[model samples]
Target: MSLVARIATLAQRDAITTTGIVLSGVWLFLVALFWLLAPGGEGTQGGIARLVVMVGTILPLVLIWLAVRTARAIAVLRAEAADLRQRLAQLRDTAAPRGAPRMAEPEPLAEPDRQPRAPAPVPVAPRPLSRPLAESRSPAAPAEGRALDPVDADTLILALNFPDGPDDSLAVSALRRALQDGDHARVLRAAQDVVTLLAGQDLYMDDLPPDPAPPAVWRRFAEGARGSAVAPLGGIHDAAALDIASSLLERDEIFRDTAHHFLRHFDAMLMRHLPDMDDAQIAVLAETRSARAFMLLGRIAGVFG
Candidate 1:
């Protein structure tokens, strides 16, 4: 399903759950109140007793139903978590340093006919995060492209790409480090929360008033990210850096939506133009990576039991 669709579904589920909880609470409270306030006559005793029994029997059943539904929701999240691990692996593979681009464009394909033919197909250009590679790197340690061990590679990646400004990265780093230090449940949960936040966002949530949508949620950001007004093609900003900072602060449920919105735009521009299609490098943290991060994110945010 599309990201937007999934978000809508989660919202619906939340609504249903919340309404059920409220209705059940009200019913139980009213029933209890009636039980205590019943007329103190022998004529009413038997009916009041029967009503208490019915409430007792039905309340447990309702609670059980709610528990089962919650469990199923968690199962869905687990599947998404696995997908994120695979995505991160794929992203790491793509980030492998490729040989420097060979200078000089290939000559136009020789045409047999003299008529004006189309120009040679252009290779998709990479839209590298405008800042230098060093700037985006986390400060704890630096390594010259190291080989990743399935177990430690993720932590290493976290250590390598830490964005210092947000607590999420540090929180994420702690989880990874804990994993490296042999804390499995903690690390796994943390990764899940990050993924959860990215894939689903809990915004102005069920109990809160709505936040108005921005007129151009991303317009100013997109404009400032690349190019000075005078030289759109030549200039670039640290917009990705800003994204790393801002989205981490967003509510965990909807973190994925916020980050992916920007990352997708980056991928479309850089990879969409390539000819072979398969050869272009896209840097979006998507597919499985997104799922993993959300799962971990949920855990860290204290939403996961």
Candidate 2:
């Protein structure tokens, strides 16, 4: 690629360092050449000699700093790429079929010498309840037959971003640092890091040029109507739904924290599948999970429905 394209590509990850390093290299070369050719000393232009001396001394240091910064950014991207590759390999291994290993034949048991007496038969009482109390009190509706609405799906997509909300993650704090430093490259890289973390969990923003939500639903959402946000999000449990969920969480601190809690709690559930979690903690996590799912996929239109 051409220099511009190369710089642009690097800009996505470490634009400031990339540009600075290039400029510093050129400046260092020009300064060094001028000093060598002119021999900046007595009988030379005082201002030119002073400028050459200053540039000659500072450019190498600037170049070194830029090079180090670029190297560090490249290292971080490489690490993340390695991690992604590892996860993909793991998934592939899990999905791939494996052949059963061969086993040795077992020896047959010898027959008993004497006849053994049979135990007497005992009658057992039938169980009192056929089902659990929780199941009996609240029956779940059939989730498979329900269809997703276009508008609600769109709203779920829109909910993925919280442009005006504050972020709670360290990555966001780094993003702020990049912004304060006016480093577009670092800013974009930091933003990508945050987005990747969300995407790893299958959350995404559904908005693109064409807009995924129905026009009517979009209007209602844009107008901030109380009932326009309702959608049947409970049934949306796949990676695609995660995209929309992630987008919403990024845009809204409340949604982000809620999603964070849901993910961490669900992770805990997986780790503690043996039912070792406290009843209160389980109840809270379960309720949060259910509520978040409902809000994301439920069919009640409201301000935050």
TM-score of 2: 0.26
What clash count does candidate 2 reach? 26
lDDT string, candidate 2, 1-305, tens digits: 33544454455557556766777787778777876897445665688867987876796877678776777677556655565556544433332222110111223323423643221221111112111111001112213543322212111111112111223222222222222222222223222233333334443322111112333432343243435252322323454564565466556453454445543332332243313333333222222212234334322122234
Give the TM-scores of the predictions, in the order they appear: 0.26, 0.26
lDDT of each: 0.35, 0.35
List model 1 lDDT by residue over 1-305, tens digit each.
Answer: 33654665577667767766777777678777977997766654587888987978588758855875885587457556655555544433333222110112223323345643322232223212211111122122213453323323233223322222234344334333423332332333333333223223221011111122122312322333322321222111234422443556563324454344434433232232222213111111111222223323322333222
